[model samples]
Target: MLAGKVSLKTVRSFVLHVFVLAFSCLMIYPVLWMLSSSLKEGNEIFVNAHKLIPSVWTFSNYAEGFKGYSGQSFMVFLKNSFIVTISSVLGTVLSCTVVAYGFARISFKGAAFFFGCMMMTMMLPAEVLTIPQYIFFHKIGWVNTFAPLIIPSFFGTAFFIFLVVQFLRGLPAELDESARVDGCGHGGILFRILLPLLVPVLITVSIFKFYWTWDDFFSPLLYLTKPEMATVALALKNMSDNTFGTSWGMVFAMSIVSLAPVFLIFIALQKYIVEGISTTGMKG
Candidate 1:
């Protein structure tokens, strides 16, 4: 009976492994196709769309895509994207941490009410605020610049604030008391005691900020007009000229390039991301 049960368990494990492997291949096939297409000639892309490996591999798509449009190279767009992404990440981490710490640790008049309002903002759809934000930014002369992309991040975001708040709540209040006894004020307690412990969540916040800002297309499209000021997302869109003909190979090449940083960052910090999400009271 024991031997029979062992054999059944082994068979079940083998089946599960096969199922998971098949599902992973299904998920990865599109990316593989895109990578393959990026190396193929424009005409051959559609004709050989089903093929995973190209018959004639070429690097000209990457060359042409990097050559860029108008007066700027793809490097210029990448630089603009890096500037916006880095600045936004810094601003988000700073603002969100402070705001979340306040909500989590400090108590004052109307604090609960204010926190409730902030939570409500998360429930509100971003599309609902688009018109109002555009009007406001336009009135302030921020419509045509990176200011529109970078400035609002300084005010803190609902999701990041919430994440940090949850993480902060999990931390023991005794740390704050101990810090106070050591002549540390609230700022000192935050900076000296809590911040070090909050590294995982901060990394999570940074990862979120990095990817969102890097991948943002709609805001850049809505605000930026000059080709020189375009981000990678906007530049990729500009690369596709349907008026003449879309360069499918170049588009695919640039898309692959655009995805590189996000993939690298995620791979490098995946452990921290998993730890942060798992331990930060998100499971409930």
Candidate 2:
């Protein structure tokens, strides 16, 4: 009976492993297809969509994709993306941490009411505010600039604030009292006592902001007009020509290139991201 049970368990484990492997391949196939298609000749991409490996491998797609529009190389788009992404990440981390600290530590009138209002904002669809935001930015003459992309991040976002607030609530309040006893003001309490403990959540926030800002296509498209100011997302979109034939290979190549930063950032900081999320909301 013991040997029969062992054999059954082994068979179940084998079946589970095979199922997981098949599911992983199914999920990864599209990315593999895109990578393969990027190396393929333009005409061969559609014809050979079923194949994971290209018969005619060439680096010309990457070369042609880098030969960007209006005398600018793809490097310019990448630079624009990096500038916006980095600035936005910094602004988000700074503003969200400050706002979250206030919510988590400070006791003041209507603090609960204000926190509730902030949380309510997260429930509303971002699309609902787009027109209003556009009108407001236009009135301030901030349209067509990186200001539109990076400025709002400084004001504080509800999601990041909530994440940080949850993490902060989990920390021991005794730390704050001890810091105060040691002659630390509110600023010192925050910067000296709490900030070090907040590193994981801050990294999580930075990673989230980095990916969001980098992958953002619609906002850049809506605000930026000049070809020179275009981000990688916009530049990639522009790579497709309807009047002329679209360069599928180049588009795929640049798409793959655009994914590199996101992949690298996630791989590097995934540990902190997982830890931050798993720990959030676990404490009062």
Candidate 3:
């Protein structure tokens, strides 16, 4: 009976894998098509949607796209994206972890109420605050600058804090108690004992923030006016003016370049991310 059950589980697992693989193919198909299309001539793309092979493969589209911009090179857009993403990730991690520790460890007045308010921010749509946030930034002279794209991250993000708090709560309290008994202050205990153990969750938050900031467009559109200030997303949006003159090939090449960093970051740090999520709500 046990052997039969094991065989049944194996079959179920295989079925699930097949389903997942099929779904993955469906999702990846458009990307593959875009890449293939990018290699073909501008005329060939519309002329031959049914044709899988390019009429003529050319790397010139990518070259021409690079030369397409007058003041802003693709390289510069890449650099600007990296700057915004890295700074925002660092800011979010620092602010979120500290705030999470406060909510998880401290027992001050109105703590629960304040935490509820934090959660409420998550429920609010970005559209609701977009205009007001733009206005507020305008008042503070942040428009048309990296400050608008990158500065909001310095303030602790509510979602990251909440995620961290849950993970922290699941951590064993005895560690904190032992640290306290050894004459360690809250700050010391947090720095020496807690933060070190919270590495998984910290990594998770960093990865999420990095990806989101790298891909965000609305804020950049609202905040940055200069063509040089465009992120990868904005660059893609402002790609082509001529209905027939659009360089789909270069667009594909640039997109792949844009996604490369995110893929690398995730692969390098994915272990910590999964570990952090797995450990959440398990602390006794």
RMSD of each candidate? 3.1, 3.3, 5.1
lDDT of each: 0.90, 0.89, 0.80
Collision pairs in model 3: 38-249, 170-283
Model 1: per-residue Cα lDDT over 101-156, one tens digit each: 99999999998999999989987989888889999998999977999999999999
Q: TM-score for model 2?
A: 0.92
The TM-scores, one per candidate, come to: 0.92, 0.92, 0.84
The weakest ten consecutive residues by lDDT in model 2 span 275-284
What residue pairs clash in candidate 1, if any at all? Answer: none
Candidate 1: residue 207 Cα off by (Å): 0.6
Tell me which of candidates 1 and 2 scores higher on lDDT: 1
Off by over 4 Å in 2: 1-6, 275-284
Judging by lDDT against the true structure, name the best candidate.
1
Model 2 C-alpha lDDT per residue in residues 14-106, reported as the tens digit of each score? 899999999999999999999999999888999948898889899899999898877889999999999999999999999999999999999
